[model samples]
Target chain A: MTTDSLKYLWQFALLCLLQVLIFNHLNLGGYVNPFPYIYLILILPISIGRIQLLLVGFLLGLTVDVFSDTGGLHAAATTLMAFYRPLYLKAQSPREGYESAAVPHIKTFGFAWFLPYAALMVIIHHTALFYLEVFRFSEFFHTLLKTLLSSTLTLAFIFLAEYLFVSTRRRR
Target chain B: MRNVLLFIYRNHVFFVFLLLEFVCFWLIVRNNNFHRGSVLSSSNRLVGNVYELNNNVTEYFRLKTVNEELALENAALRSLLNESKYISSGRKGEVKDSVARQHYTYIPAKVVNNSTDRRNNYLTINRGILQGVEPEMAVLSSEGIVGIVKDVSKNYASVISVLHQNSSISAKLKDSGYIGSLVWDGRDPQVAQLMDIPNHVELAEGMLIQTSGFSSMFPAGINIGKVKEFHVDEGDNFHSIDVELLTNMSTVSMVYVVDNLMRMEQIELEEQAQTDDD
Candidate 1:
C-alpha cells in the first residue's frame, strides 16, 4: 500500500478505537448519544470503487455494532449510506464522481452542499439505529427526538474532528 | 462473459444495498424473540466483554466527579441521619428484631455503563459478585429505589434500570393505600407512569408514593416518587398518572443494594408449588 492508503487505514483504525473506547460508553442523557463511529464511513477516500465502499461501510459498521451490542442496526444504516453515495453525489452535480485528486473536505464539496450532505447521512443513520433498538413505533415522538438530538451531536463531532485532525489535502 | 461481469460490477452498489437491507431486516426480526436473547444473554459474551472494557475507561475518567458527588451526598446523609434520630425521639414502642436494620449495608457503585439512550435500558455497575452483591438485590441511591439485579457474574452484573419499559415497581400512594405499577413510557427520565389505579380513587399531584412490599424485589416504604400530574384517561376506568421520580438516575453515583434475607426460601417455596401444580 502507498503512504496515502496507509495513513487512511491508520486513521480508520484510530477512529474505531476512539469511538468504541470513549463515545460508546457515553449516554449523555436520554437524548444525547454521540455517535463518532460514523466517522469511519464518512471519510473514506473517493478513489475507492463504489462496490468496495459498500463492502467497507458494512464491515466498519458491523465491527462497531458487534462491539456495542447494537447488532445489525449500524450495518443496515451504513450500507444504505454507501449505496446512496452516488445518488447524493449526483444531486450535487459539481462534485459528481469527485476525483481522487480532490479531498472530500468542506473546501472540495463546497460549503453549500457539504453541511447538508453530511447532515442527511448522519440523520438517516441515527434514525435507523435508534429505531431498530426500540423496534417499535409505540413512542415515535420520543425516539424521533432522540435521533435528532444525537444526530446533531454526531454531526458536530464529525465536523470538529475533521477540521482539527484530518488535513484537507489529497495524497499523491 | 467479461461484459456480464462488468455490467454486474457497475450495478454492484444497488445489489449490495439490497443485500445488506435484507440481511439486516432478518436479524432485526430474529432479535425480537422474547423467550430469550436480550442484552445479557450468553450469546452476547463477546460484545459484553467489549462493553466491559469500554466501561472501564469511561468510569476511570468519572472518578473525580463521583468523589465530589459522594462528598456532597455524605454531608446530606449526615443531616438525614440526624433527622431520623429526631423523628424517632421518645418513641420506645416495642420494636421487633430486624437484621435489615443491622446487616443491610450499602457500598457506593458508580454506574460504569448505562443505556438511557435505548428503550429498554440496562445499567452496569462497578461492583459485582466478588463484592458480595447477588442477583435480585435492590439497587438504590439516597433519593429512591433504582432497580433489582437480574444477572450476575464474578466481577460484574447488569441492572435493568427503572427507566426500562419492562420494569414494573410495586408502588402505592402515601396518602391512600392504592397500589399500581410504576413504569417508564420510554421517554423522559424524570417522568414515569403509575398505572392500574381505579378512577373511583382520588389522586392528587405532589403526593408521595412508596413501595408496597408486594414483591420480594424491594422493601416496604421505599420512596418511589411523587405524583406530577394525574387524571382518568378519556373514557377509561383507570387513572393515567405521571410521576416525577425522586432519584436522578441519570447522575446517580453511589447506591445502596438491598438484599431480602428470606428471598431464597420464598423463591424455592414458590418454585416447589409451581412444580407440584404442573
Candidate 2:
C-alpha cells in the first residue's frame, strides 16, 4: 500500500482503540460521552475518495460498536458524517482553495476556519448517534440536551488532541 | 438503460451511503431483539479479550473497594451458616430435607466491561456458556440484583443491566406485599421508578423492595431497593414511586450469574398450559 494509505490505516486503528478504551468510559455527569474518534474522519486528506471515506468511517465505527456492544449505532452515525464531509468542505472552501495535499487540521487552517468545521461535524455525528440509540422522539428535548453537551465535550477533546500532536509533529 | 446507468454512475456515493446505512439499520434492529445472539457485541472473542486486558490494568485501582465488598459478603454468608445460627433440636427434622430441593445455582463472575450512562446499558462479564452462564439467567452483586444475562459467548457474556430502558424487574414491597415493575427513568443512575402499585396501598418512604420471583429469572426476596419517594397523581389509580437502588451499578465489578435448574420444566409447563387454553 502507499505510505499515505498506510498512515491512514494506522490512524484508524489508533483512534478506534483510544475510543473503545478511554473515551467510551468517560461518562461525565452521566450525560457527556466524548467521542474523539471522529477526529480521524475530520483530519483525512482533502483529496481522499468519497467512497474510501465512507468505507473507512463505517469500519472505524463498527470497530467501536464491536467493543462497546452498541450494535450499529456508531457505524450509522460515522457513515452519515463521512457522506456529508465532502459537501461541507466544498461549501466552506477558501477563496484560494485548499492546498493539493492538505489535511483538514488546526495547523493547516487557523482556529477560525477549523473550529466551525469540526464543531458542526461533531454535532451532526453525536446528534445522529444519540437519537439512533434512543430510537424515539418522545424525549426529544432531553436527547437534544445530551447531544449538545456531548458534542461540546467531543469538540474540546478533538481540539486538544490536534493542538498537542500536530504542533509537536511540525516541530520535528 | 444508458441514461439510467449514467445517472447511477453520477451519484454512486449516495447509493453507497444508502447501502451501508441500510446494513447498519438491519444490524441495530436484529441486535435489539431479546435473546438473539450476535457476534457484534463485546462478548465476542476479540472484544472480550481487549476488555479483559483493560480491566486487568484498572482492576488494581479498585482493589480496596472490591476487598471491602467481598468481606461484607463473606460476613453475610458466614452469618447464614448453620454454625452461626442456634437451631432448635426438636424442629430440625420436622421439615424433611428431601422436600427442599436445590433450585438456583450461582456462578461467580467478574465484570470485564460496564457502562451506566447510556440509555440502554449493558455489562460484560468474564463467565459465559463455558461456565454455565446462559441467556435469561439472573445476575446479582453482593448488595442486590444487578441484571439479567442477554447473550453468552464461550468465555464471555453480556448482561442487560437494570438501568436499561428495556429492563423491567418484577418487585414488591417488603412490608405490605404490593408488587410493581421496577424500571429506570434514564435520568439518574441511583434511582428507578416502580410502577403498577395501586394508590390505596399504604406507601411509606424507606420501605424495602425485593424481587417478587413472579418471573423465573430471579429468586424471590432478593433486595432491589428501598422506596425513596412516592406520590399519587391527580385522578390517578396508582402511586408514582421512586426507589433508591441498593447496588450501585457503576461500581459493581464482581457478580454472580444465577442458573435456574428447573427453568426448562417451568417453561415447558407454562407453554403447555397456554397451548391447552387455546
Clashes of each: 0, 0
Model 2 lDDT tens row, B27-142:
88888898898989988989999999999999999999999999999999999987997766765446566899999999999999999889999999999888899899999999
Total backbone clashes of model 2? Answer: 0
What are the per-residue Cα lDDT tens digits for candidate 1 across B110-197?
A: 5655655566666666666678778768898777988766555565666768987668888999888898989998767788999999
Fnat, 2 decimals, each candidate: 0.49, 0.70
Query: Can you give the lDDT of residue A90 in candidate 1?
Result: 63
lDDT of 2 by residue, A59-86 (tens): 9889998888888999999999999999
Candidate 1 lDDT over A1-172, as tens digits, reads 4986787778767877777666765677567878877776666665667878888778777766544445477788888777776677667656345565655666566566678878988887888788877767887888888888899999999889767875556443
| Top model number, DockQ | 2
Chain B TM-score against the true chain B, candidate 1? 0.71
**TM-score per candidate, in order?**
0.74, 0.97
